[model samples]
Target: MKASKVLITGVSGFIGEALVFRLLVDKKFIPVAAARRATKFQGLCPVVSLDLNAPEAFPAFDDVSVVIHAAARVHVMNETASDALSEFRKVNVDGTLHLAKKAAESGVKRFIFISSIKVNGESTPPGKPFLADDVPAPMDPYGVSKREAEDALKQLGSETGMEVVIVRPPLVYGPGVKANFLSMLRWLSRGVPLPLGAIHNQRSLVALENLVDFIVTCINHPDAANETFLVSDGYDLSTTQLLRQLAAALGKKCRLLPIPQRCIIIVATLLKQKAVAQRICGSLQVDINKAHELLGWVPPVSIELAMRRTVDHYQDKQTK
Candidate 1:
């Protein structure tokens, strides 16, 4: 098959960087890197300086067959912005709409958006999981923005004949992962005795490799047109199980105390860390059956291997 030119936003981000490398290695797609500091992929492919905040600032999208929209105003742990919703909408909503319009005008075919599971709500019941067709109930500013962006993109696609594919993924982790996932790794590596052994909440996570593979599948799959898909590792793990697996990957002994879930939540609420507690103890699982039935897609990487690679990278960086 002939290679296609794919313009990828957020080329410097963890997923974007991995996607670019994957495309390069597969030799099936030509990646046109776009980011604020686009020089990172300068020599690898064509580079374009893109600022999501500046919606009017866009580069020529001529000849780009597909666009993987990975950039966004990501969730902040301690947001200092005066209007967090407005700040997020400025980039994730307005910026995304503008880019999609430009791409449509330029004759781009498909737009694959990287959305968040937060759009489906913060948590789910023990056995129930989020589905792609569920009514959206975003909980935070960042998630609201993504939901708005998804709506706008679908509307734009309907009006302009461009196909839009929205993929909502749960916590994604792999090599170069940051934020809470990395923090968990750090805590476990230090052998911190966490009082999370008794919690039995299930959470779904996607490996960076699995997500990148799914995005590539969406780029040209005819069945993916104008569809919303929920993606994950197809495996749900409890907090205790996750810690144990991570500790094993890091070559450390897992230290956990059988603290009551209610007590943990109460303490976190008192400390104004209730949100953090919810993430650790809450259930957030996604059903990926739609992706499987429609695109015949399955995660090519195992969680165990993904964690091993992540641990290897983290250990290497620590040594350096």
Candidate 2:
């Protein structure tokens, strides 16, 4: 029997790149990488340039067994675009629908979408975590676009009989990471004393390796079809704890002042950075019980190990 061919979009991204490596190492699947720009890819697999916005970018899906859609208009802190929502929908919604239609027409068996936890909501109510089945209350344009794409994907799957599996993950951390996670890691590396000590709010996070593992499992799992799942490190941590752990991983002592959370929020509001402040100080936890009961999947890497790998990679990059 031949290995099934899996199409991975956004193959150059941090999560996508990790997923690609996982698929390549598995003898049961062949990963076909697709991205908007030219990626080095290290000649690991067949690379194809795909423009999600272009109808002509459709793949020869006849031989493809699965489509793992990872490309999307992600969140931007300071978006200067004229219409942020429209820009996001163009690629995140319209482009996604176009790809799914082409894949369905070409007889692809499964479509696995890598969604974000932002689709669930930004922050959870005190002590209560966000569940997979909870109603969506998107707080930002990026989240709104993701919710739209998810709805469209499920509808398309229902009409076309394509197995659509949605996996919504929180902040993902690991080697070659970027964005806020990268900034956090860089800050920890400096061993600077900060004023985030009073933060005891729980926030969920997933390691890059663990997320890729879950995605690989969903490829052919019968139970994963048409189901949405949320994943994490099987552990939630407070902002202070996370910073301390990160400092430990970098072999530095974390210096955190026990500043009041209310004070921090007030400062953020004054600076017009309430959203940013909330991310650092608010609680956003996810319940992964659905994923556990349905897929029998667990994150392979622990939080401590994940942090070590992340810091090590950061150190290596700095040296190079």
Candidate 3:
């Protein structure tokens, strides 16, 4: 694949920001970033204001060879079920279809979609990790929306001649990360003893840098077209192990209380917080062997390094 112009949506987001930076550094390709709000990275690339939900809002795909769609409504608590489904369809599914159609119309070569592992399922069974070929059984509105978006992209690929690549990442974390991951980091920083120590369930996660690398590799990888991949850091850790690693990264001794899982669940059930308990104690893992065999891509950073970088960013933010 030759160096070509690329258009990336949600360039201000965590994965998007890292991706744009990587693209900017690549001398072969020129990057055009599209988002709803203006970004401080104006000097990095051509920034275009685009509202993907608007029917008339379509970027100039004429000169672009690849379109990387990374924008979506990602908050779990900020939206109701109805609102989430509606917004996800408008942005994740409909917006994706619109762009893919335009990409096909404009003679774009490839369309890469950044999807979530939740599309596979929220929690994996006892000993089975999610595989790329497994049937999608989304557990939440957000996952359903992503699965729909993937279906729409696949349909576009079949109807038109455009190549589509879908990459599903699990729990992406690194610098500039927000949401639940950040909350956990804050708790660790406060030296709070969390009951999560009792949960021995394993969860898979990806480093933002590794995810960016995968996205870039998908741009023109011959084997990635019309394929779905489940990506991770190639490792899984329990909640207790995760806190210990996070504490190590922060140069602090781990302070975790191993409260019995059954007791926690019982109390949470009585308090109507079972959902929260499930999120913390559930086991979720992804198998990325297909990605390795197809794209020959491996995570370049270790989990420890990634966590250290994440902690460093938080320290920098606190200092500022």
Candidate 4:
């Protein structure tokens, strides 16, 4: 029997690259890399350049059994676009639907969309984790575009016979992680004292390895069809706990001042960084029980192991 062919969009991206590696390691699928720009895969797989910004540049889905749509116009902190929402919809919504239609027409069996937890909302109230079935309440243009893409995907799947599986993941960490997670690692390694010791709000994070594992499961699992799943590490941590863990992983002493969350927010507001403050101080927990019950999926990597890998990668990069 031949291995199934899985085409992964955004193959040059962090999550897409990781997912392709996992599939290759498992030796269960023939991974096809697709991205907007050229990426050297060491001739490991066939590479196709498919820019989501180009509405008509559709990659040929010949012999593709699964299409994992991981490419998207991710959220921008300081957006300079004239119309941020329109720009986001152009790539995330319109581009996604166009690709899905082509996949469905080409007999692609399953289309696994990598959505973001922002579709559910930015933050969750303490003790009230966001469920997969919750009413979507996107708070920003990026999140709204994701929600629109998801709805459009489901509709397309229904019209055609292709199965659609949506996986919404929170802040993903591990080796090669950037943005806020990397910043935390740097801060801890440099022994910069943080004012997050008093924050008790819970946030859910998924390891990059763990998220790839889940996506692999959705590739062919019958229960994953037409389902929207929220995934995490099954571990919720406070800001203080996360800082402490990163510090330990980097072999540095955690230096966190017990500053009031309110005061930090006030300072951030004054500095025109209230959004950053909310991310650091607010709670965004997701309940992965649906994934557990339906697909019997569990994050294989523990938080500790994930953090260690992240720190090691950061250190290796710095040394080079």
For candidate 4, lDDT tens digit of each residue in 1-320?
89999999988888999988888889989999998777867488888888876757777888999999999999978899999999999989999998998899899999999999999999989999999999999999999999999999999999998999999999999899988788888889899988889999999999998899999999999999999999999999999999988898899999999999999999999999999999999999999999999999988989899889999999999999
lDDT for residue 18 in candidate 3, whole number 0-100: 82
Local lDDT at 43 for model 4: 87
Query: Given candidate 1, what's the lDDT at residue 189?
Result: 90
Question: Which pairs of residues clash in candidate 1, taking residues 3 or more apart in a chain or in different chains?
Answer: none
lDDT of 3 by residue, 1-320 (tens): 75688898888788887888898887668888888889876887788887887748776775899999898877475465656688778878888888788889999999999999989998987568999989999987889999999998898899998999999999999998899889988888888878777788889999998898888889888999889998999989988899999988887777888888788888899998897887788789999999999989999989899999999999899889
Q: Against the true structure, whose lDDT is highest?
A: 1
Please provide, for model 1 over 1-320, each residue's C-alpha lDDT reduced to its tens digit, 9 standing for 90 to 100: 66889999988788888889989898898999999874667898888888877766788896899999999889989999999999999889999999999999999999999999989999999889999999999999999999999999999999999999999998899988999889889999999999998999999999999999999999999999999999998899999999999999999999999999999999999999999999899999899999999999999999999989999999999999
Candidate 1 has a TM-score of 0.98
**Per-candidate RMSD, Å:** 1.0, 1.1, 1.5, 1.0
Write down the worst ten-residue block by lDDT for model 1: 37-46
Badly placed stretches (over 4 Å) of model 3 are 81-83
Please state the error at residue 63 of candidate 4 in Å: 0.8
Best to worst by TM-score, what's the order?
1, 4, 2, 3
Which residue pairs show collisions in model 4? none
- Model 2: weakest 10-residue lDDT segment is 53-62
Error of 1 at 118 (Å): 0.9
TM-score to native of every candidate shown: 0.98, 0.97, 0.96, 0.98
Report the lDDT of model 3 for residue 216: 88
- lDDT of residue 30 for candidate 1: 94
